[model samples]
Target: MTAAVSSAALPALLGPHCTVDPDRLRRYEIPERGEPGKASGLVVPQTEAEVASLLATCSKNGVKLVISAGRTGLVEAQRPDGEVVLSLEKLDQPLSFATPDGEVFRFGERAAPAAHADALAAWWRGIGAPPCEDAVLEVQAGMAVDAVNLLLAPLNLMWPMEMGSSSAASVGGCIANASAGANAVCYGTAAHLAIQAFGYSGDGREVLSDAPAWKAVPEDLLAINSAQPRPEWGLIGTQGVLGVITRAKIRAYAIPGQREAALIPVSDMPAAMRIHAAARALFGDDVEEFEFIGKPALELVRDLKGDAFRSPLARHDAPYYLLLQVKSHKAHIDLAGMLYEFLADAVSLPEDQIGYAPLKALKEIRHSITEASNARMRALGGGRLSFDTATPVAVFGDYLKVLEAELKAEYPDMALIAFGHAGVGGAHLHILGSKDAPVARHAKALVKIVFDVTQDFGGTFSAEHGVGTKWGDEFIARAPAEVRAALIAAKRRHDPAGTLSPRSFALDRQLAG
Candidate 1:
């Protein structure tokens, strides 16, 4: 399966700086595996033409290819199994904003953390509204998510998606994984922000993009491109099955005013639900985020670290805590009392109700605790476990209880963290544990248990983080048969020779089922 593509052929395939090194491929493929040993040889192309040429060659010779972006991918999607790797790392091109007089006020730079800040430099050029009439931000696919945000944030603007691994994860990686962050409560996932992408087909012939013959198709692929295939069960349906994302047009703008936040303690799950109900009744539009965390999740954050982890409860009786956020604190009454008092008074009424509150200074306490605890968590150990699912906001009440029962049965002694946009019915449920646990079989088993329970309630198996090679075959088979069929069809349309990434979409034993 390993072929030695001649060194002279590579010069025509990539930019001046690009190379094809066996060692580099080894590095890119290592991290994604359970043991960092699954990666294969490398092919780093510096330009889109080179990328296209590489794919064309793969097609002609029947070579399997896996694309690597920022290298922060959690799954083994990019873990090449003796296949050629089409690296879009050389696509780090910079974009900018300015006057026609050549008075360049600013520019959007596309470089890794090691490079200079570019996009934010341009963000400051025009924060009110961008000029240049339909000026598209054509960021090079190799840029990392955090670098993009830092570039925009100085001007109070931000890139579309945010992942916990943003600093190390690349823009293309975010698109491939359909990354989401805390703000996904208001803004959507990467899939929503990704407007267009410049990709190549394995056939050596260009197939699609907004500008191609299939111009009728929207760049966002919102309605699904008949010419292209979508992923069956998770986001980034195109990561492996389709071609690599070399360039993308994304929505970028100013970050809202200092986003206001609060951390409040709830007596029970119902108490947390009550707060969610009253908030929806009040600032339905302004409320940007609503997150919930159980005592066990917090207890783990505290146990691994210390007392700094945010906790509203001194006593273990409450069982959970609620973290709510607003764009502005324009609520008329005392914020805490407004939500809690209403819950304790009127809102609680069976299936029509949510958890109520004893929250006196909910907002202030929540912010203070988060600010205090997050620091401790950083000092200790653990990345945000950040697993999430969403159902109809109406059915979320019923779903949460079922989700809890499922977790208790499967993940006892493990810390489970749940929070994020309850108003939208999407919740982030992460399993807090030692990094050591991430490599353990027990932890891997729980991911399935959590997904099974979440799926039975009619929730999508994945909300933001796309399924990569990390999860097992059962997870992919769990999806509906029609969906899988469509996904495979999409894969074939783009990567017909099965020479792209085999790991991105698993079509092994569960193929027929």
Candidate 2:
């Protein structure tokens, strides 16, 4: 099929009800600042019939489709230029409270991601938490992370997925990428939290995915101190190539009766490692999040935000910062006391360097790093490449040291910024090059070095982010032939036309096969 469809013809085929203005189409064209590509025209389907009609028209006219929701993704998954772009913006509707299950929320795919948070909060006000055990919320694809949290907060419940872009990311986008942020160390990624996903396949076939993708890992097979694996959840992060996630049944956690955060300063990586080990011993199941902020990252925040950036530790000059959250369901349990005593007895954390801070305050400090890096890049007139990779927790320290050494030797002048969930092995490394350096050239080289090191350490190149076209080729090249073949077959089975996010997952070559 050739990409020859005219924008004007879209209204005739799909009807004016689904057609979008050129101004709106331009907005969807270029989503992120640095991301490549754009879109030609848009079709906003207010009803399921409209969606189906648009799909059928596109299929008949040989027009490709790219499913988009909060378009806040770093990878270019929504590049629909020269194709019929279907926007779910108008499908937003109120929560269906008359459902058979009180725990479930039937949502329209076009619901704004932020609305879920509002809905959950209102629901809690109307009726409290689930009678006995925790409950699940069925959210539509376009709901935002902040909105879900806002609604869930009053009920002493929350959808635990964390991302820097959570405020803007759609629930469907989160499920698509399986984003696991700072809290992923304890709560696991979006893949683990999503119990079921309902979506329309590329060829316009509706589908439900409730079963696990891979077998359960035996307890004996687990690494010495590694977190549990949910292989079945791997199906959640397909980058919207396989299908468009319309609705998802996700688990919500009870709000801890008690919550406290402590910022522990460490001399170096080795000392930081000790604090993580001690956290496991002292907090155990109560540990909610374990985040690390290297000196460089902290300095960036300090410089950008000025005195507004409050450091939990008095001496913000420490080599590394350990941000730990302790939570307890029992209101009577003294979490603060427990953490203090552990610090006193263990001697792993330096006595003078440890300090307590409000959870919200610490989170502000952690989130500011992203803003600082982006500000730096804007000022430097060059783009930055951030790599999210993970190695075994045991080798994470060594991996960090090696990564720093290699990056310094290769790009001596480049700024190195690091922070993320330390409990798990996931690390976020952002590097900004000189103003004169070619953005693409530096990005390519940095990606190669990082991915190579990640592979050598028996880690993954794309940790929480899905392998979009940006990383799709490298991901395919590294996969075993059998695994790659399996992926190809699955793509073909679900999207025979390969019309949705074509070239994603490296499935373009599978058409003839």
Which lDDT values do the candidates have, in the order given? 0.54, 0.68
Deviation in angstroms for 29 in model 2? 1.8
> Model 1 shows how many backbone clashes?
23
To one decimal, what is the Cα RMSD in angstroms of model 2 from the true structure?
A: 4.0
lDDT of 2 by residue, 23-121 (tens): 767777775645545565677766555565565566557777777777776656665546656665554333332222545445444445456556655
* 10 residues in a row with least lDDT, candidate 2: 220-229
Model 2 CA deviation exceeding 4 Å by range: 1-4, 17-21, 33-36, 91-133, 211-235, 436-441, 509-513
Candidate 2's clash total is: 9
lDDT for each residue of candidate 1 in 299-328, tens digit (9 for 90 to 100):
545654454343344444456666666554
